[model samples]
Target chain A: MKSASPLPVVFAAFFRAGLRAKRTRVFILLALVPLLLTLLVRVVDPKESGDFFTKVMLSLYFQLLVPVLALFFGSSIVNDELDGKTLVYLTTVPVRRRAVLLGKYLAALLLAALLVAGGFLLCFLVAAFGRLGEAAAWGELGVFLGAALLALFCYSALFTALGAFMKKSILAGIFFVFGWESVVQYFPGVTQKFTVIHWIKSLLPIPPGEGGFLIFQLQPSPPLPSVLVPLAAGALFLWLAVLIFERKEYILSDNA
Target chain B: MSTVLRAEKLSKWYGNILGISDINLEVAGGITGLLGPNGAGKSTFLKIAAGQLKPKIGRLTVFGEPVWGNPGLFRRVGFCPEHDSAYNEMSGGAFILLLARLHGFAGAEATERTDKALAAVGLLESRGRAIKAYSFGMRQRLRLASAILHEPEMLLLDEPLRGVDPLWRIRIMQLIKDYGRQGRTVIVSSHILSEIEAMTSEIVLIHQGKIFAKGDIHSIRGLIDSHPHQVSIRCPQPRRLAGQLVAGEFVSGIEFAADGGGLTVRTDQRDRFFSALMPLAAQAGNEITEITSPDDNLQAVFDYLIGK
Candidate 1:
């Protein structure tokens, strides 16, 4: 039976499952990825903490850990069921497949948000430690955190859509992360706009005229376009997730 | 009896393999045994009826509504799938409660329903532990509990008794019969003939993706009884046994095994053949050690029916 409004139930199920995850322990080490870079920057040149902070956020959070974390959480929303053979419980229930996809997608988004948010906050504290109550410092932190959240939502939704569409979406997601998003975000002109990280990097407080390996190498789109495109595209991707999940006929056993 | 399920030209196939071929059937309210050998399209038929799979050729309706992808029909239906699966992370109690809540039961009533189902299946004591910690038999019973917890009107059980203990098996069978008494429909599938026989008389025999027969067990039994019966008798005095057995009018053919080992008799009238064998063997110096029916299995009966 097709259930009415099954998304909430699916979300709650995934939320509970995520809470029970032992991966929270692993997340501590992951959160340290950005923190470790900050520690290295302070020991080398304590005066250039802000410059190093932007570099650290781009290299660690945006380039590596953010997308990696989103991939793990989002892909597992559907992949966990297919792998564990536990999707039968949800599929057999009269709930709409959209609700199942969205609910689990929300759960993955929240977990990814929590992980990135925690890491983002810690990196800020370490970078600007003892630079208390500076409006400019806090403003830059807000932009960075906001960009990270938007990036997480967009990338995680993309991965979740990939998961709903295919069983072997993990390999594809890894390729997108290492091959596409990582490589394309650095390309000059409009090509960088094609990557989620490009828009994310645009929203950062780094001025366009700044000279660095990232700035001189990659010319980003305007900040407004960067933010709106991924957001709009994320919603579209999420919609496609619901569409595919609702229509897909997932066979639980070896069909006779 | 009211018709609980109706299928019209229902068929399903996966790739080159036929899951279940063209089938038209009506099931009235009671325990209806769906008997078939392994890979005989039993699970496929059940999945279609339970709304798990779509029909490739025709239609299947549970209580008049098309079952596939229809969640509203779930209010009246409960399906216990053949696959050994459960949310292993949730405790037995939590799993039952989740289904009950899904059915819109409130806090106290949901708890009551969950408790009743667990107690009914004798899993109340293990309610606190995770399902993954459960034994295979307990998980099977837990699956049953989840199905019944919502008090669904039509229960579809695919191999419900697999890996169940004898005592619980009897209890579950009784519970099914009780549901039937309440006028709810229950369709149970199993390879075990005696298991199906004990639950209810009405049955649907499926063989190799086709409906071989659909009727009561006795009616099917009559078919087997009417078939040329083969009885083997291993005795010390084979000549004496054959002498008494061949004299009967029902005994059409008889042969003694090589080395004068045992007697094999084919007869149209099994009752008369047995009745004649008893008296002749009872006489002085008549020694009978073993007797067996190799054709007692449903498959053998089905094969005979098809061959005929």
Candidate 2:
């Protein structure tokens, strides 16, 4: 019998469910944080609004918010099912395990993208108030948005693979985001390249040395490598997630 | 009948603890009850057959294909897991619909299959309600609906009737019977002897991760009847009843309850003992109020068979 393609089916089902999830509600509110802060900057000091958007706002979204969102969404792609004991439902279907992982990954990625893009757009509008009409300002907004998507793609895939491999991957994911990404990104030379945030921050419009130590410090990688690194890493992580999901034997209950 | 599922020397374990060990079984069409106490490897065995877990040592196949990593084999197999789990946010209709779509149905066909499955389990009216709002029984029925939604030829149900109300229990039993009548392969697991007895006479008694017995109920019961059985009888005159019953050949020993209101009788021939006791009790002033076999449960049966 010719079976319907499982990827689209799983994607649609999980996407609709994720939209109504309580986590999504909290994220919608969390995504508003950057927009709210940009509004504060616009109100407090109109003259440095653009500078704040480029240096501080970009750092906040790229370094903190985007990766955090990706971590939660991507890791949850498999972790939620494991904890909930709902992986059986997905696995028992006449669909490949890879399809299930990829479908849920896509659904999660889309949700994360929407949240980051929506907040970034609102923040961009407020920070670039008068210069909104200029192509340069819009062009900057496009670059930041592109970088945010790439970051989410790469980080979420890594987390998804971690989740598929281990039950308590979120703990490790938090350490990576707050610990490794935070500490390693500031190590001056080649060490910063070890972090995913390095490739992401390299793509930002804000030049290095402008945003102090917390933001970018050294020369960014060439634009081609910046885009390719995250893309290639994301693909590799996603492939790993699919491999782990397909082969791993999950023990759902302690009922022996 | 051709075999639908086969496990060859299949074994699995969690750490040092065993799940199922060296299990070799072949099942054909019709209902076969997996009878065992909790943690007897029923769920573990079913999970392996359903492709939820890979066997540590050996192989399991459905439709001549390895169950693990064989998704297409599910097109002819259905599994209702023991755990009470579902996406709480999604409505029942949506959940079943998603599974139907996964089975390759689309558009109006998927909708029809979903509705038919819901209706079969008597959840059609509650289809729009969120699964979290469902009672334990309703969730169970919903899980049943999910399994049968695709109308697979082989069905594996792990404690499907658990937490279901009496009314729904009978309905679900009838539904399972209907599945068997259609010549479909159904392997239903339960710790309750009568529950399995009610569904099918063919049973595989599993204990401590091994199959203790496999046959019709009559044959297994014959093996069990030979074991010494304790029958607790509550009577007004326990000493008098014990005196009248102690002389029988089937009566092995007798113990008086601490309360002095009941007598426990150990009988080598349970059927013969009951036959003699019925006439003796009806005679006069023997007035037996209650008669219960504490060891009637599957656990006690396993213990007796294993010489515990």
Candidate 3:
């Protein structure tokens, strides 16, 4: 038998398709919201732009947008195929199921990363326009981008596994983001560590007393563990997604 | 003949509803028409064979290996599903080319196969158009093109002719016949008996989650032909036509229309009855306006066979 097409071929085709997808367009608009907010704060009060940018990055970008964007992009990796009844085409190919899932997952991850990076870069440039020459300011931007990447990797992988496990994964993801992450991250001591946001929040360069109601009493974990936990968890979740996808028999139609 | 597909005591059920039950059969290469009515076990059996669904009980194997979770088997198998589904965003050529690439064809070879498959299905000119813009019949043909683009040893088509125009239907049927003639296994499923009958003489009759019968079409045709058939004839002189039909050896019984506009004739031999009715209606005195066999369809024949 002929060898199946390489993983790059599947990744390239799906990546191009993912860019044109309607969901990606919606995400592009969603990612732009932070940039718009940064611009508005910069114009109204230039002195407070730096501080507002930090708050926006923490509450909106990291806590809300990153996880939600990952949820949309990552869950759709499997859900979209099932909904469109296009899974048959992918499953029937000579390639292994793991290759198909990983190829699509990589496409979704890249697409989500582009959205977050584009929006974050613009928001950072607008907020730190006056401080561009300073090394410390550039370092802070790098840290934020690094934290955002880690948060996205962790969240997207988690949601991708959820999508493979259940059909109505968006509902479950919404609850995890709002109900579990929102409430659990604020809990004192070790309990907050259970939520993914705790590790993400620890990586952010937020001063102890500055985040108001969102992170006033937040006990951030050490930077190393924070970064390591998300990386390890993301890898675990991604492996789970592949495991479920390969073994599970998805019924394309009404059992026919 | 070497067995291409085998199902040993295979059964599948979705909760309370049974799909196929205890289906033990072996299919050899050449066209085997899966003849059944709607909601019969035909689609279920095909889906299991295609590796789309796992059997709830027993096993189904294609080319001696289990089909479920066997992506490698697809290298030798092509399946056109029953649902009218496609990536509406992609052009017909693009869709076929993607499947070609997935099947391991690269560069010019993928494009060539795509071109050939599209041309075979008469979609070559409109290959660049998005599938959504095409009519239902066009999409059906596109699905057929996708399945054949790989040129696998076995083709499993589930209601492939559905929504196809009459002109293309004959062409598609001929294409399937050519595949059979080339010594490949082509299993085409359809609810219509004449559709399957026109394609191949070998058939498997499935109904209510079971294989009711399997053999040459002639045997099933014999059973249907022997069943009492009702022929309704509208005529100006119903009494005269009934009087003539009463003497025929094929006429088992006759009933006059309550409206006095037509007569319903029961015949044991439908072909002979039709032959006798033609001459009577052609006579100068007899004026037959219309003639229809009410139970001439396969559904009625199935109902009689299954004692439904």
Candidate 4:
């Protein structure tokens, strides 16, 4: 019998399963928080809606939602299987470990993307309601979506690699998201570039002072390099996740 | 018969605690029962053979190739783990179909194989139900279905009959016996002597962290059956039962209960004593309430075997 490619098979199965997952439902609610805030701001102060949207996008979507969503979803790609003691089923199959990890990673990445995108679209439509005819408003929305996608990719890949390397990666991922990304993005000069958010922020159209408290003393890099760094970093992290998954022998339970 | 699995000086330990130590063994194409008490390294040995674990020392191989880090070997191998785990969110059919596709079956073939496997385990009727909705025995049958979906040449089952009802237990035992009849290699592990005895005769005894013995079941049964047995019989007339039992050649000693309702009988030959006790209980005026064999446990058998 001819062997089918395991990557697509695993990806399709997990993707469908992921959509119905309770965690996905939770993430959908998390993504909607920004849109809810956007709607509230538009109602209270119509003229200041644009500024409110920008700050919300930066603070909630970019700074919080994207990375946090990526962290939970990506880390669960392998960690959930281990905790549930279901890794044996996947690993015992004839398919390669890399195929299993990569397939599950793709499902997580797509799921996280959908959550972020759905919420961002709603927020954009509401925030840009009056400026719907303006082409520039649509362009700005495009930039935000692109930046969100890149952020999700980089953070998800990094967390996926961390998940494969260690069992309790979520706590460490929380530290990385809240502690490192939160504080380091505001650091001065080259030190700020050490954070993933810095590169993600560089892709945004917002100027230094316009981002309010979340964007203090910001220095954005060139758009081209900003895009390239995250893309390259995401690819590297994904490759690392696959490497660790393929070679590492995960002890599914306490040695019996 | 060809050796399908071989372990050479294999030793595995979790830090200070040992799993299996210096074990040299070979298993051929037949149903070989791994008999041991809990925590006796039976699961550890099966895990290594199933490629779920790596040996800390020496080596373990299946089909003349190393098991660890070898995914391709699974094409010919099926492993039913001891743990009760499954994708609770997925239906039983979906889980088995997913594994079938992973094993390289496509489209109709996958569905057909999955249906056949589920039917074999008598789970076809509940295949559409979510795993979490199923009872423990159903989940166990699902696990067994997942292993047999592809009809691999070798199967490693760790306590497969656990949580199963008596009716299904007999059916599963017959199914495993059928697999052995097909000349396939099957290694089944269980803590219960009779559970293993009911499946196949070829047995391997493990204790602590080492293989105690490996041979046919009768040899081990001989050692176990000969062990001193203590049977506590509760009857309305204790003195009558004890007086009758004392004359039997198999009776080593007898002690009557202080309450005068029962007596604990120590016998060298339990089969003979039980055969003699049945007639006495059936006789008029002698009422037997309960007959309990406290020393018939696997631990006692192991203790006697190891001590001997």
Q: In TM-score terms, which candidate is top?
A: 4
TM-score quality measure for candidate 4: 0.89
Predictions' DockQ, in order = 0.16, 0.56, 0.37, 0.58
Pairs in steric clash, model 2: none
Interface RMSD of each: 4.3, 1.4, 2.2, 1.2
TM-score of chain A of 1: 0.91
Model 2, A88-199: lDDT tens digits are: 9999998999999999999999999999999999888888899878999899888989999999999999999999999999999999999999988888879989899998
Deviation (Å) of A94 in candidate 4: 0.3
RMSD of 1: 8.7
Q: Per-residue CA lDDT of candidate 1, range B151-237, in tens? A: 889999998888775557778999999998898999999876656887999999999999998887897676667777676767777
Model 2 / residue B81 / CA error / Å:
0.3
Candidate 2 lDDT over B104-166, as tens digits, reads: 998889999999999999999999999999998899999999999999999999989887754
The DockQ-based order of candidates, best leading, equals 4, 2, 3, 1
Ranking by TM-score: 4, 2, 3, 1
> For model 3, which pairs clash?
none
Q: How close is candidate 2 to the true structure, as a TM-score?
A: 0.88
For B101-213, candidate 4 gives per-residue lDDT tens digits of 99999988989999999999998999899999999889999999988889999999998987776558778999999999999999999887666887899999998879999
What are the runs in model 3 whose C-alpha is more than 4 Å off?
A1-4, B225-298
